[model samples]
Target: MPENRTEISELGEFGLIERLNQDVILRNPSTLKGIGDDAAVIEAGDHVKVVTTDLLIEGVHFDLSYAPLTHVGFKAVAVNVSDIAAMNAIPTQITVSIALSNRFSVEAVEDLYAGINAACEHYGVDLVGGDTTASRGGLVISVTAIGEAQKDQVSYRSGAKVNDILCVTGDLGSALIGLQILEREKQVYLANPDMKPDLEKYDVVTGRQLKPDARMDIIHELREMDIVPTSMMDVSDGLASEIFHICKASNVGALIYEDKLPIDKQTFDTAVELNLDPITCVLNGGEDYELLFTIDQKDFAKLEKHPDIHFIGHMTKAEEGKFLVTKSGTAVQLKAQGWKHF
Candidate 1:
């Protein structure tokens, strides 16, 4: 007899999410947004509340052998915060839940909390509440972030219009390069137990991986400049993947220039050293935690002087199709190869 079963890999992470979200029905009128975007939008009295959650599991999302518990705890909080930022909302509170195995001791848990508390303080968000549970496997952390924004200020992924300029904050691909360095060091350490990892030379890339900050600064600055993005999402799932999400949600096409993709000097050098394609990493590597958004052409001048923001592309009519114009002047179809967990 032949058995029929489908693998999760066949569906992919985003595909699985799309499949699972099909059954989710919003009964409340206040649920302005649901599973599709970075955060669920709920209508409040004078503002909209953006709620986002993330789950981090050992050996999957992170490896305990290389990642410190404190850094893991901070990352757990930051990733959710990044989602809130993607919605162009200011985070106010967070609930952090953790599942721990017997392998972790009380002090270890406290070390984890030290990082969590530090992140809460840094982000100026209150750690309101959470739940604790015992796990048979390894450490697991789930963070739910609640943020508030004026109804008109919240940027949705579906709001991009044709001709809006696409902008991304900071640089891309550094975090992936960092991860590569970490993995390389791990292999070296495993092969030679007495050899210490030469992490000092690769601090920039490694630090990008170990500790990432969400782009809350950009959101605040945009608010100050009276600039609102037409559409926005965090670059947590690679830049190309995020561009595709905005394109799909907004019913638009994108044309990005290869020469304009922002990559840090260290990130580029390290990627080359690792024998990885720098542009590919920039396009497909995940977890940079930078903001990707589209702004009205009229609002471009207001942000023209910003140091870190890079305008790599612009939205086009949907029929034009998404493309990347290479430095060689060839237009290639863009592909989304985001973080594939399945």
Candidate 2:
């Protein structure tokens, strides 16, 4: 009585997107892009409009038990804004939709909106409009962000050229380390409800996990400096995974240096405490939300002195192969073990 049913896990998220993209037919001339890139591009007069969407489910994308609704709201907006920035566009508006069950009170919803409103103000984006509905399950939030930029200002994953300087913003691995600490504390709390979590010392790592700020500041700085990244993407997955994406998209290879990888002191310390290799955490950790971009070799001098940005390596010819040059002067092939829900 049952038909053949394939589990979504079998195909994976990217696989599903690839399959769906095959059936998509772009009809409108104004529609410059569909799926595949960080955001969809649309021709709009002198500039192009970039649109991106993300859906967050309670249990799958987040654990409501540990994740505060306020932080959840901020993260939801920051993630969407990150995509817009990846396209080298300035976010102008966002529409947020939420489906709630009776378990959440109106006051709780207000707390969530407080974060959303704060993010909107921080990013200078208007909360245009969205829909709300009753859900039998836990909270579900969907956000769509719209941004704009000049035709020439847009950066895509496919724009990296051989010999371009690979750059990363801020640090990596903090968020993943923070998650581990939170989970550990949560387990402790569950075992004995009276124990208060000593979270004061881990504020930096915890903040990275909760209220991640999108690097629109860097985007604005690039504009001010008159520099456009040859290629760009946000580090949602991990450094290694994101580098692989840029390489695959631009038909190039990369050679990163282990010593050049950026890991915060708190992240390194916490990772050591949790028995995770700090470098491994930097390479494979997820949700750092930093910008990973490539710049022309000539433009490197301009950004060389930037305190927050790190110059890890250079883009290489596809046949050169992706490699990580260790601190001891040994080279090893790079592997991407990004976050996988399935």
Candidate 3:
């Protein structure tokens, strides 16, 4: 008889994660959090420790045909750092593990580490320890980041209150736009080996796609200004998806303004060039690595003038429903097309 089977695609990425994590029993009292937040939280003596991990597989998470190994290494660390930033914590240490096939020589691995070290230095985090192993497929990288924050200062996805202002840092949609450009160039190269790819003009979007920087600086600035986000999550799965997570976790709804949505000139233009809607890209595009958060109304004055941060919307009661108010004064239901991976 044939064995019973269920397609992973049917469950999707988040669904698969949820199913796998359903049985992750925490045996230690120190495990304040596990498999749910941007990072796990552990009870420390004076402060809480936030831990996060990310895995990058060749072809699936990245394509080496265009993505340089250095950038891949850098991104591997930055994504984890972004999660720590989402928790309003400062990254302190990281352990990097890599699985490489024989196709990668020692020098190639060293080049990857060069970028990893650079990211560590950039984020002010120490490299503690990790494992190295052989793989039959392409390269795989996984990183675990540890961060610390005062218990009170730690922001959770569940902290948003009604009337809290929804805030997003920097512009959105750039990374997705950048990815389109890269993919287009790759196709061009594959079609004709002699044709040189024209990439110089699309640097802004391509750079955003290739190597994204976590908004750790923004996190630091918030601490310096004595502001704590009521609820926060990193914009790894596009603005709309992250908003839905924040809303669900906090038991609230959000009202975001279409006009207030931030988009880069390059992103908008590229989206138009590719015949993709810029606004749709902003709403559903993923991997910007910016922070999506809600702040108390009283703290708005402190960040009102900050040029990088955008005040996009505010929180509402769950029954009010999640919406995006258009420039023409029409309200539309917000939809989440987060990373599907299934």
Candidate 4:
């Protein structure tokens, strides 16, 4: 008889994570959270530390043909920090490890670190330690970020309650549209090396793709307002997919409004130019790095006058199921078709 070989593709990314996490047992009393959240929470004396890591590979997470090494390094750090922010923590330190091929020279590595250093300064994080190794494959970067917050200030995906207001920061879908523009330009250049890429017109979208800023600004403002969100997560995945995560973890449902979804004018225009539905892009596009969170109804007034935060929807009973109330007054089931590594 043949040994049963389970294909990873059949399980998908989240499903695989779930399957592997099933048997893992947390034995330490200090391990406040192990898996199944944006970041792991470890108990500290008066405060808790939030830890998160991310892996970015060449040709997979980025294309060196278009993406500058500097931007890649910056993004690598920003993503991990974003995860920390999702837990309502202030990032303090990061350790960066990189695997390099011969293709990258010392100057190339310096350029990469230039971006990394810039991000470290930008986010007020220290580059405490890291590792380096040779790789036959292209560049690979791994970043582990440590953040601090009061034990009570930590937010988890499982904390959302029924009737809590759903809020999102910045805009959505711009990064995905920017990726499309970059890819289109890459193809154009490949077909004709003499032609220069005309990216000045698409600068906003392209910038969003090349260098995404984590919404740490919003996190700081939330702290100032003394509004600890009921639940939170960064929108590294698509808005809808992240909503699904919050709902599943919190054992609740969400009803987001179509008209309330935020999209930049440039993102909308470019998505249409690419023959993609803007709404779909906003819902399913990934890598925006914005914050998606829910707050108690009482806290809504505190953020209502805020410029960047948009109140899109509210949580509902688990039996209500997740849905999007479309502009046409149709309530449709929300789907998670975001970025899938598998």
Give the candidate number with the greatest lDDT: 4
Against the unseen true structure, what C-alpha lDDT does each candidate score? 0.93, 0.93, 0.94, 0.96
Q: Against the correct fold, how does model 4 do in TM-score?
A: 0.99
Cα-based RMSD of the predictions, in order?
A: 1.4, 1.1, 1.1, 1.0
Per-residue lDDT tens digits for candidate 3, residues 243-329, read 999999999999999999999998998899999999999999999999999999999999999999999999999999999999999
Error of 1 at 299 (Å): 0.8
What residue pairs are clashing in model 2? Answer: none
Query: Number of clashing pairs, model 4?
Result: 0
Writing each residue's lDDT as its tens digit, candidate 1 over 146-212 gives 9999999999999999999999999999999999999999999999989999899888888788889
Which candidate ranks first by TM-score, i.e. highest? 4
Model 1 residue 72 CA deviation (Å) reads: 0.9
Which of the predicted structures, 3 or 4, would earn the higher TM-score when compared with the native? 4
Candidate 2's TM-score reads 0.98
Scored against the true structure, residue 78 in model 3 reaches a CA lDDT of 96
Stretches of model 3 off by over 4 angstroms after superposition: 1-3
Q: List, in order, the clash count of every candidate structure.
A: 0, 0, 0, 0
| Selected candidate, larger lDDT, 2 vs 4 | 4
RMSD of 2: 1.1
For residues 1-342, could you state the per-residue lDDT of candidate 4 as single tens digits? 669988899999988999999999999999999998999999999889999999998998999999998999999999999999999999999999999999899999999999999999999999999999999999999999999999999999999999999999999999999999999999999999999999998999999999999999999999999999999999988999999999999999999999999999999999999999999999999999999999999998899999999999999999999999999999999999979987
The per-residue C-alpha lDDT of model 2 at residue 8 equals 86
Question: What would the per-residue lDDT of candidate 2 be over residues 71-141, giving only the tens digit for each residue?
Answer: 89988999999999999999999999999999999999998899899899999999999999899999999
